[model samples]
Target chain A: MRMKRLACCLAIAAFTLPATASAQGLLENPADLIWVSVSAALVFFMQAGFALLEGGFVRTKNTVNVIMKNYADLCVGVLAFWALGFGLMFGDNPSGWIGVTHFVPGDLTGGEAGFMVFQMMFAATAATIVSGAVAERMRFAAYAIGAVAVTGVIYPVYGSWVWGSAFEGSGWLSERGFIDFAGSTVVHSIGGWCALAAAIVLGPRLGRFGPKGEVRNIPGHSLPSVALGVFILWLGWFGFNGGSTLAADASIGKVLLNTNLAAAAGVVGTMILLTALRRPVLITSSVNGALAGLVAITAGCGSMEPVFAVLTGFIAAPIAVFGGDLLLKLRVDDVVGAIPVHGFCGAWGTLAAGLFLDEGLFQPGVITTQLLGIGAAFLWAFPLAWLCFAGINVVLKVRAESIHEQRGLDFTEHSEVGYPEFQTDLPHAGRND
Target chain B: MAAHDNARYSRERAVISEVLGSKLDAAGVQSALDLWDRKFAGQKSVPLIEFVNEIEAVQALEARERHELRLALYKGMIQAAAGPTTTAARATTRATSPTRPRVEFKGTPAEIVFLKIVQYYGEQLRVLGPAVMQQFLSELRAALEERRMPGMLGDAMATVAMRGAVPDGVQWGNTARMHMLAQGLYVAACKAAGPVQADRILLGAVNQAKQLEAAKVFAPSQFL
Candidate 1:
């Protein structure tokens, strides 16, 4: 009887041992935790890039104003995302329309916290894009309020439709095989659409058009700052796309390579196009081309082959250039070309993700899914943001008064000036008086 | 008494006609002159202030036209007080007079007229802020220098830049140069403030100079 009992215990041990080993293998890796944390840090650093890019693009009088908006939006965005956006985006999605649990995200696992932090940066990115489009004219307080609405409601609700299954039930869009690896449509295009709405409601800057409706060039103040900003964004994008894998794996090598190839292809394509059009190869347009490429590849970087990524980015140049001209013809003043580089290129990138899928190129069903997702993003983000801005305008006035605009927002809003030494002729330096 | 009244009426009518004739027809001019005469016919001397008040009360004339007429009348009265010297002779006297040591500006009529407009706008902008006036003059000088203006025009702009104002007794003889300078000022004001404020400043300056013969010849709209 004792020998039989011992044999039974050994049999039970044999059955459980492999199961325990498999469970241990499935546990989170320390390397993944470290990589994700570092990537989140890199993504956060993109805010500085945004600040420099926007500040350089505005006039000297409005430089400080743009920087302030960039800085403030991050602060407002992070807190709003932390309070509500993370949960709405990644919580239990019983209805598949919105997440219903995990508000404020307490007592989370290490992996969950890292994910929340990483996604928090993306929310901030979406919030900050509007600052550049509405630069030189938007009221600071109204912008802060708009940032809250974006991160808390607009961005997260849409994000849940694509990425909600991270914790629980799957989103309908993701279930339909709509693949957005790192959010060309989910992040950049949503922000771009919001920017479009805000810019439309705010109207063009004074004298941007002539009596007969001719377009005028409003050159940015600093090319060096713009160049520096693009370089920083390029560096940050490696982490942006690579880190989306959520693991320290060999796939990151392919993702980073594709991202870099796309950006390079973007610059080459822009230079070639400019030469073809008999226009000067301008530094600002070149940098903007690089950004457009980065935006375009963000959706498909994980799924696209290197050559297809290059094609995706190359095509984005004309979209950006002509998209800008289209806005001018439509009388929409998108300062710094945010609508073109982010919005139009982002949509193109989403479509490219479907067309350039590594599994098979130009799958009609996949392309249709991508088109639906892209259309949904514009429909969801634009009108919602327009209503928000119009409501904000009614309540708090989103556009600055013409008198205050003439004095520059830096002086009128912040009691500061970017170049005080050059302003020696001005009374009291930074003071409005 | 009737002869003296006729002489006063003829002198007043000439000044009024010169100012209002372009804006008003002959019937309107006659009505304005008759209204002035009827208002002050019994008085031994009519005060300039009362005369201006009566012009301001006229319903048919625009406020701008009334201001022009008032300015023209004041100039006529001053010329009459200074005796029968022609404008050229008075200008020569001022230039050569020992009591007033400052030299007179000897540019062409257009140049002098444009300079006066510049000074007028400059003064008006100064009322807004000294910095505004400085920025306007600086932009004007920059525009002048950008054209590589030669001779007296360049020298005049340099002096204006140095003084941070349009200096007295200097000639900017070329009408084109003056037009460029005015355009520069408008552009600068647009940058410093905005197009609306810039337009307001230009309109005010042009209205002040509308009665001048040279202003009609140069036409502020050309530069604008």
Candidate 2:
């Protein structure tokens, strides 16, 4: 009886809250609001996915630091996004440069609250992507500063250029008919390019490259953790992509199906390449391939054919592998290959949307417009990130000292360790060195 | 220093003395070792020897009978004063590892030549004394790392950029003439895009640098 009363109260509040005319029916439907809330919760759960993924990839000594960074991504992300990012991204601005309203979102209606909650997860997701790139050696203070900058300015300002229309007017990029049904470039590329800048500025971890410019392999600590993390991220992607629909319609099933197909194609494509190159069929590369596909399809999943989705994912596999190799050659030590999986593949997917959409690339100006958006994203993301990191580096040492890095950030930065082998008087056993 | 450090240092000193005995007279040998001690201070000598061995000038001498002697002098000085350290040991391990060293060019030949010229100037400019030199070198090292400038080029560029050859007591390095010499070498190397051209350009630049140093005109200038 009490549960019914609570439901009744929520229903009344939903109806009483002011909603846009277009959203009136949506506000009237309690079921739709519940779906949005549930979807937002699932997307928020992806923070755990990122935490495990990043933690498993870094050295055991730095595991706690990496996980801490992941947690902070959401903690800082939510506050920053609420205070400034949402307004900059979604508020009305005639110039189309930035959103000028909704700061702190104090007067939000019921529908707006649901929307804000959902978008908040995305803002957190973008911030979490950077945590993986600068994992072991970044200073906590530097990461915090970077998180705030990304959530508050770098991400939302560009988000205003693309995703602003869902709330008010579509960004100028959307005005040009650039299609990014979900953010491959807006979220992934922004974070990826930011990672690139941070990695470049941080230099490589000690001994990552030799005096003669020889590259060394720094393997992650835990494959099992990696596997679990990838699976969770894969599961969460259903909400990430499907929930973008913002409705419980039949089309969501197609989006989910397409998401899975692309992921499978990504695996097959990566495995085939691995076989051809005579490389081992390791799960790390496999997971990366699937992620690349997921990132690629994100731009067009809502509008693409299932077969084309597979092709997009298949193309993403090679792009991700080569993109990583390129960063290594450039001496950018992206710890989790975020630059390739997110930045490069994100750009490719955004452009591919123009190629595979119903009108196709042959359509006059569509390809050009998409190219413009892609170029704009890189031009905006890479330099702003470089400047942000450079500024932080000036205020605080962005990279840890050699001693701190050698001892591990877990103890040096956080005064704690993830594993308790010494305290327990047990053998040190976990994650291959 | 610990016993192990002393033992290691002594062994390195002995190896350097043996190597340079042929190329250097006794007094010259002592002077070189003093320079090394004054320059490198706390660093290890092993990597210094290894670093010089990687240099083309030292490599060219290796073709002659007195190559070991020439290398030893360079190695000894670097060990005693300034050259290599354990930090470089990690890098050396890769080069000597059973697996092939993953050799990639961090700097082009021109860039490396530019670094070598800078090192020579750094040594000459040491009359400015340790405090000034150390602070200057620290700034130079930071710049080099930021620019990915070769370590050899660090002190020279720093000297040129920060303390151009001037008559002021506080500004006692990077004279106007030295500025021209350094710039000439850098420009020559850049223009010498190919390997054959690199050797010619470097040799010519070094010759010009030597002439400038011989003149030793103390002129105040902002050529840098």
Candidate 3:
């Protein structure tokens, strides 16, 4: 009865708020929904971009492995999220620190199915981000297991605390109310951090470093693939940042503007820094910079002005490139910089929301509260993720195939190659290196 | 046999190093041991060794960022011995006119097959190249911008017009430069089209790419 009363109140509020507040911006709030949806389509399409980009970066032998990881992510991520993740993430709780038990189709307490769908997509995205970092060498089964944990447990339990109603007003749960108007922390970091953890465990790829820890450059197989993938991802950010508004309103235009500016800034940031380092515009670095900019702006997109957004992306670029190197120093072998861009920058994005926003930065000290929200999120998700990984590692005994790793997983596991014809020109196409 | 060979090689390397160093000094012997440790442990030298052969100087812009970058580099240089001149850079079909000289010329096998590819695809005389410039109106270009660059070769070249099977699953930027390169090669092949020895080798390479695509060894670009 209490829950139903909550439901009734929500339904009434949902109808009343949008209707009453419906004012006409040039883009209009309601029309923003279409724009936001289009943005989502781009983000959804990024899976392919990621597949090709990563495929091109690694040895061509691993190209099949690259596509497989992406394929598994979309297929499995949606399933886990839909089946149970939504219920735990948005459902009511005592402190919103963690959600209580609920699973299966009819079990969602959020009552509104739309919110669940949004959460589901966020969960899917967070889950997919890990595939890139773990890319070439991880066992297929282990990666699948990681996907399940992210969508079902790691993402939702943390998501609920900040978003859990503005419930129980201003406690650890409510005060910080994790102001992720979108999911820099909830989605990007969860994937990013998990990538960090997985990379640490997996160790570096065989030829990644030279003697005495000098890094060797492994040029991608196709610059065109990388370029195409980056363009695809750039198209996706419109949805990634825009959809966070969760309403079809004036916020849409601001979201779109901020998302675009930040991405451009990311490119600018990476290009400048890289040029300074005397490094050429690496397809990998520039592409990763674009992604970092996207991740940095995600939490603050709805609230920030354009200039601030450019700064946010610019800051994220160095953080991404260097942070990737930092992970390597820490002996983490993140194949795709997932942790740096998503995990490290996600955390920064959420916190930057407090530091950067205009007068509107989180409805007042909701900024401080947002920090608390992020803390709570860390508290909620980290241990759970660690345990989930521990469990998967124990059960699956997921180790990279020595022969397969040397041979490349594509032909070994999947019986496929990304470029079969390119083999003819090269002397040792099929011969295992 | 190879395993034994590798082990034998390792042993020889170790002996050669030790013998060479023993005549130097105690410091040299210690240094040799250190070198051995690194080699056996699979560590590379501290300073990086640059590969001189591998550097490719293909200066171009993001095809998505702008056009013309791809075309000027590819068509003006590799294909026509010149990338598209700025005036000719607008994406347009070349083989669209049936009367637009189907002139086939002959060269080596590599050249022979290039013409065949152009012969099969009517108007894409300048579509596929290394740089991402506006070239021929390609099924590939439209698909790339939409972020649905195909993984399979067939899907990449498949269009509403005269479709020929392009089997080389070499996924690169769908830039105008790349398109022009493809066109230049194919046209050269077409000009060489009368029965020739070079024809078989060129066709063989194209066929391999196609076979690989058929085998599902290749996937489309992750543009979308």
lDDT of 3 by residue, B29-134 (tens): 3333344445532323211112101111111112221133223222322322222333233222221232332334243333333334444443333132211111
Candidate 2 overall lDDT versus native: 0.68
In CAPRI terms, where does candidate 2 land? incorrect
DockQ sort, best first: 1, 2, 3
Best by lDDT: 1
Q: Candidate 3: global Cα-lDDT?
A: 0.57
How close to the true structure is residue A81 of candidate 3, measured as C-alpha lDDT? 70
State the weakest 10-residue window (summed lDDT) of model 3 chain A: A18-27
For model 1, fnat equals: 0.07
Per-residue lDDT for B80-106 in model 1, tens only? 443443431322211122121222333
TM-scores for every candidate against the unseen true structure: 0.67, 0.65, 0.59
* Residue A309 alpha-carbon offset, candidate 3, angstroms: 0.8
Q: Where is the poorest 10-residue window by lDDT in model 1 chain A?
A: A18-27
Off by over 4 Å in 2: A1-28, A359-362, A422-433, B1-224
Just chain B of model 3: what TM-score? 0.18
DockQ comparison, 2 vs 3, better candidate:
2
Clashing pairs in 1: none
Enumerate the candidates' DockQ scores in order. 0.06, 0.02, 0.01
